[model samples]
Target: MEALDFAAESLDAIWSEGAIYNIGFERGVSEWRRFIKPDGILAVSELTWLTERRPADLDTHWREHYVEVDTASAKLALLERQGYAPLGYFVLPRRCWLDGYYRPLQQRFAAFLQAHGNSPAAEAIVEERRHEIELYERYGQYFGYGFYIARKCHYG
Candidate 1:
């Protein structure tokens, strides 16, 4: 994989939406912190457990797929530990996923299945996506995307 290059302390702001989970949350924040100037900003949207108690199935699904999922308060604590001050956070509305992402993706998946004659491998991938969407639909009250805003601290 090709590496990304960014000068240390060069960025005024770094924004990651939905993709940070791929590298793991804390690791992503820690790695990107070095690229942001002191007093700069970092904004990230992460999958978060909204309720104190989540259903076992929901918990298991995320534990298997996104082991780093946690609460908003936990993320705020993490920000402070990483030398950033928590600014604010908001839960992204359900439409943001259903309309903005999964709906369009479902359409694309349908087209792919049609064009590819619904091969087993491709159908399995589509089914997995469908299952994820269903989980969000059913358990949306327990979890959601949280948009976190923080500023890098200047320790002068």
Candidate 2:
């Protein structure tokens, strides 16, 4: 894999939206912290549990897929442990998931299938996304993307 290279404490802010899962939440913040100046900002939109309790299926699916999926309170505490001061946080609204994201993605499925020649693999990908949307429709109240805004502490 390629690497991230930056001078230590050079950045005034780091912002990541719906993409930090590639490195995992804790690892993303920890690894990137050294690249941010003291008092620099770190803003990220991360998958988060909206409620403390979840159905077995929901919990199992997330833990198996993204181990760091956690409640917003726990995520905030994690920021504290990572040398950042929690500035603000909120879960993206349900409409953000349905109207803004999944709907738009669904709209592209037919063209994607056409471009891919309607291969089994392409169909499977579409099915997977459909399944994901169904799960959200059923269990939306339990989890969502939590947008977190923080500032690197003056002293770690």
Which ranges in model 2 have alpha carbons more than 4 Å from their true place? none
Superposition error at 62 for model 2 (Å): 1.6
Kindly list the per-residue Cα lDDT of model 2 for residues 74-104, writing each as its tens digit: 9999999999999999999999999999999
Candidate 1 residues lying further than 4 Å off, grouped into runs, are: 115-117
Model 2 weakest 10-residue run by lDDT: 1-10
Model 1 whole-model lDDT (C-alpha atoms)? 0.91
Over 27-72, each residue of candidate 1 has an lDDT whose tens digit, in order, gives 9888898889999999999999998799999999998999889999
Which residue pairs in candidate 1 have backbone atoms (N, alpha carbon, C) closer than 3 angstroms, thus clashing? Answer: none
Q: What TM-score should be assigned to candidate 1? A: 0.94
